[model samples]
Target chain A: MELYLTKNFGKPNAIAMAGYLKHGGYRALRKVLKKMEPKDVVEEVKDSGLRGRGGAGFPTGLKWSFMPQETDGPKYIACNADESEPGTFKDREFLEKEPQMMIEGLIISAYAMGVNTCYIYIRGEYATQTKILQQALAEAYEKKFLGRNILGSGFDCDIYVHRGAGAYICGEETGLMESIEGKKGQPRKKPPFPANFGLWGRPTTVNNVETFAQVPHIINKGASWFRGIGTEKSTGNTIFGVSGHVNKPGAYELPLGYGLKDLIYKDAGGIRNGRELKAVIPGGSSVKVLPADRIDVPLDHDSLTNAGSSLGTGAVIVMDDTTCMVRVGVVLAHFYRHESCGQCTNCREGSAWLHQLMVGIENGQGKIEDLDLLMDVADSLEGSSICALADAAAWPVQGLVTHFRDEFEEHIKTGKCTSPDSFRI
Target chain B: MLSENAKKEIEREMAKYPEKRAVILAALHLVQKEEGWISQDAMEEVASLLDLTPIEVREVTSFYTMFNMRPVGNHHLQVCTNLSCALMNGRGVVEYIQRKLGIEVGETTGDERFTLSTVECLGSCGTAPMMQIGDDYHENLSEPKIDSILETLK
Candidate 1:
């Protein structure tokens, strides 16, 4: 049976909470509050090998350990609910279906990190999601899962919900911190990472909604049991928000090393309408694209990286043969350009330049060198900024050009996208 | 600039926060949602309600793309031309709407009935080539579908 923390989302709210509790809901927080030290909780998570479910996939325990242990200053746990990454909707599904589970997980993470206060920075565009999360939070508070001396352990933590102004950059940890601070959602430089200086310049830990939601499971089930489920490197199951030309395009919570081919063919019901798979963007749009022939590659982090992609955000977006790679490149370029935050010169100008070039190519108004120019601009922008937004803008372009240069050349030479009628640009 | 009901709504939003200035953007969102854009007086009223300076409210309104600084047509159509939608011919739909409405992107129709603008993403890539008007999504758009949509709006 699938050990679902968030996958059993169809049950009624109360029933789901009951089921979660039966499976050990607040037991982790209760244990920590009653017996374990904050550092001990952190050490457990560190030993468990739980990583951030957000795009970066940093070790959650290590992140918690980064906070100053001896400091009396206020520490924070900001849940990054701004699931605005393209092709990534797992957080939304998780929050909407099993909100209590998320709340319980947040409480556990708060206890682990010694955070007395937490914030859920939801995307403003997700008005419905914000409402759901707010209602759940209120319910949690009323049930004594949040606020003031939880379960008589004298561990007090308050959770707040802050909605972002519909900017994708706010999904970034620093940008989310900035938004919580009531500023423009632009990312800050590292070194003063959230562990050292975050949320009002105090030690903070920003974790994705899924990352926190997984804590209860990890805490309830021993670290070894949790570690045994997935590969040694990337432990635990992940919620894959599979979209695009797939027969069954929805959220699938599966083991970490689930075969890409099995997910594409068996689980997702294969390519939609029997269309042959052309490419798959393994982890949202930021990761490099993997060709159909390489579907045998496992879905774990290391395997994906070895196959020239990162298992980013666990968003599997599959493309079929009836799709134009140039057009795809153009679309991603437009997103990066529009959501650049305009903070640094490279991201601001480079995203626009890439978008314009891709638009020219897609519209059949291009020279051959535009392809090379696209790569050059993407190369220049990668790792050249304070934030990864620039690199996020560059990755898809690099993938499209690197893997499908022929498709781009065809568009330039034939002066038209060669894909079938459905994929016409 | 804001009606009594709108002012009350802004106050309700402000009440949700310990710091009134924190909800200024939300109040602005309400004002824009009702009035279709933020006016000078509306910004001033928002500032007064939030105990912030008018300049502060105006800056907040000006910074975000979702907030409109000027009046738009009755139908605010935001087309998603970003990657996934672009793969499914989102630009063609945008061009088709622009030609049919005789207004470029960011321009309102001559009669102020419709306005077109391109956005990054609407988080609904499953139904690619989609546009949002108000809160509703019109997806899987073709040139003919775009024409019918405009006719219905008319």
Candidate 2:
């Protein structure tokens, strides 16, 4: 169980460059600069089978390769620090505790892609995290890890921190590029994917903060070593941010394909207050919810996808027996409704409709016919918008209703929530 | 109007990006920091500084939840009522703050000391039932903790 990401968590001043250097930081950047070529770095990552830590889970090396090697103008690398997905707070840990690790990783990625500039497009709400990153960037620049020829490798690069203004759609690759361009955080239609045309109309590649954080380790430990840690399709360890009804709610750096049951009981100290496990959102709020019976599934990208969910940001949100599924629907639907950027007609109108229906059900005014209506609305939202925001909105509702239809029915039949008010607002 | 220092900060941010339009968010932030909210005049001033139209700046301002188009109290209490926080009784925290401050969500107190809001999520779910006051997150909230935090704030 070699910890790739959280190994330096408890170390003193791990956010500082000196603390990171003491813990063998930037050696990967130096190694890449000295021995390995850009294509070698890219191939090593592809060989490791490392996927994006963001929700999409695309192969990282293949993505880096997509950047045109012979681009005429300035190509860019955007490190997405906009960790806005609900139940997913693992990226915040790296930003606050191990900023240098992620920064070093970003530098290596910039070198691998032959990009001279990288922008860490962080969310606006992360004001404290932003300040820590700024300080860490200053330290990296002073030590010659960033800017000009780094460690005398003839690689010139500069990383900038761009703050996003409170929009979840900005987490979308194209939407992020738009925000970085100082415009509304709206998603553009793809086919002109980011690798071909991105930020400021130049070629760009965006990786999650944790995705880039894994690069330094993969280079230092080699590809086969990383491939040995996690499941076959999903390689290496990831930070799972567990919250809600779990007794010990926090980020746990576990190898991919770890048991969800163990993650809840052993790592997270089981359900809070000796409550029975009712349901779990294995990934973030965007993925499908798993009932208590499905907890035996190994947590990973492929396994979770096969088990009717995806490992989205690896944020596990647990719910105990006392929780109300109707209320859960209301909460999730409300979030999607509020955060939708109002670009596509289906997402803009459909998210509101879904929220309205969920709210009616929660308020004891829903008819049984509304159940089918909810499903129809949720289905329409999937793959119908300019970005995945609509799909993210749809999945949780579908997950809740698909597995916990009885709860929704009970509310409509009895005209009141049957679950205890202890967990409800 | 933007102050001299705000303009300087905006200029520095402008140099970081290839295009000047990209500094609009930073420029808007500077205007809001100095004036408590983004005024029409401030938007116009920022637009002039960044070579964007006032409507362009206004559209960007309205799109984001953080930029205050109108005035706010000295302390902005943004409670996260998203799923994780809701499971941890984030609504209770919002209600408690409402009773204590004598202001509901999206309302400023009569004395203008606190403005209460229920935000979506602030990414502090592990330490849930949290809220952000100014730039700092007040997490793992309880009745007593909320009292102590409010006492210190005023």
Candidate 3:
């Protein structure tokens, strides 16, 4: 229904400034700067019930209001373009197609936060995406949308595109700030979150690319209009990046409280090549997995959480019967293990531990008690880390075993795999 | 030693940030582009230019898998072996490329043309079963398609 983000993606020359403006781009930023106060903008977002789309699902406007209103020193806005979550690609597609919309969204958020300098810390693997944004940023600067007085509003701002060195932890707000500060991307402890002391110990606010892209719409169309879409509490549309066995695997902007089954069947064109669905990772790799039997649940933040999973980054990885759940567990565990920044002892050690156990199960060398051991290890890692990386690493392994216990146990008992395996390396 | 152009590029990146160290990633990118890998001398040179210690440069370099501490082939083949890709024949594509190139994972061909690496997710899961050679991504891979892609490469 009423696409906000992906509407402009398929258009020819959507990357060009003229193409973007032709489709009513920057109207929200113009409206926000001309007709609304910063407080009003934040309040509008708050009333809209727009939550952060970057896994955490924190309210966006409330996050903006966290920054000190009257900071004497410089404040910052870090747009986390470091979309490194496995099975997540919605933001990359959004940025690649509608770069201007993301920029406009960030500008509006910057205005709401009174942040003069903003940094889009994108993943380094996105060498091409980085260039596209750089060119768009240059065009915005030339057209006076980014530099000194933007459209003669007497407000000065500059946005910089920072490249992350292939670190997934940089997706975290504090890890991102540290990377920008010229260090390894590691998560900092909370208490003084990015709102109070961030980006060189000043006030800061971090938001996802899609989260900001929705801002212009919230400004242009009233908060109540946005609230009309999606479920109560989880308002507005989210980009569900469906991949793997789906026939049409791409980014679909469905209303938040939409059915997960409908998303796989209708939106993603159902399972590929007429294969029956085996399992699904409703969110990205971090969240729990839902089996084929449990596809009736609504795919939103609250519902997914209630169903014992999460709508993380809205990355729906659909797997048909051809996919082995045990192998899926192994792959995700390996990813988190590789990505764990060596700061927290539990995350650093436990991620590797989880991976080894998964490998054991996959190779048909696992014991029956290892199943309980897997859950126990996952339980231990739930709250043992300084950041959520440990929890993110632990969730998939726990999810696989909980839903597909028979499959995992079958691997252990039969000393063979249920599906064709490829990752012998 | 960094080339004059590399140094100039690093300078431009340094100006964008409030501090010199913030440009380390950008500088590393430039250095890797120029040298194919971040050499010890290159790290030391970058550290000197950015006012950071050489060990600090090494730490950042070794931390991220993108930066090649050792030398690599002329064409680097980074096949994404993560969940999405692995499920959709991503590992098969890697195996195909390895067999075609007459090399194994993390190996360089005798001609120094192709370097095969099975990396983490490259965020191209939408077009799964994919591999990245330099800046371009070769997705929706098959055995015949791998032949055509490799033919275009060398």
| Candidate 3 structure lDDT | 0.88
lDDT of 3 by residue, B1-154 (tens): 6789888888788767778899999999999988899999999998999888999999988987789999899999999999888878887888788777899998999999989999988888888888888888888888998888888888
Please provide, for model 1 over B1-154, each residue's C-alpha lDDT reduced to its tens digit, 9 standing for 90 to 100.
7778877766665544446676766777778878888899988988887777888777767667778888989999999776566666687888888887888999998889998998876666666778988756688788888788878887
Q: Is candidate 1 or candidate 3 better by lDDT?
A: 3
Model 1, residue pairs in steric clash: A331-B83, A332-B83
Docking level of model 1: acceptable
Off by over 4 Å in 1: A14-24, A420-425, B1-21, B48-56, B72-79, B85-118, B126-154
Residues forming the 10-long window of minimal summed lDDT in candidate 3 chain A: A416-425
Decreasing DockQ order of the candidates? 2, 3, 1
Instruction: Compare the candidates by DockQ and give the number of the best one.
Output: 2
Best-fitting candidate, measured by TM-score?
Answer: 2
What is the lDDT of every predicted structure here?
0.81, 0.92, 0.88
Model 3 residue pairs with clashes:
none
Q: What C-alpha lDDT does candidate 1 achieve relative to the native structure?
A: 0.81
RMSD values, in order shown: 3.3, 0.8, 1.3
Poorly placed runs, candidate 2 (over 4 Å):
none
Query: Chain A TM-scores, all candidates?
Result: 0.97, 0.99, 0.98
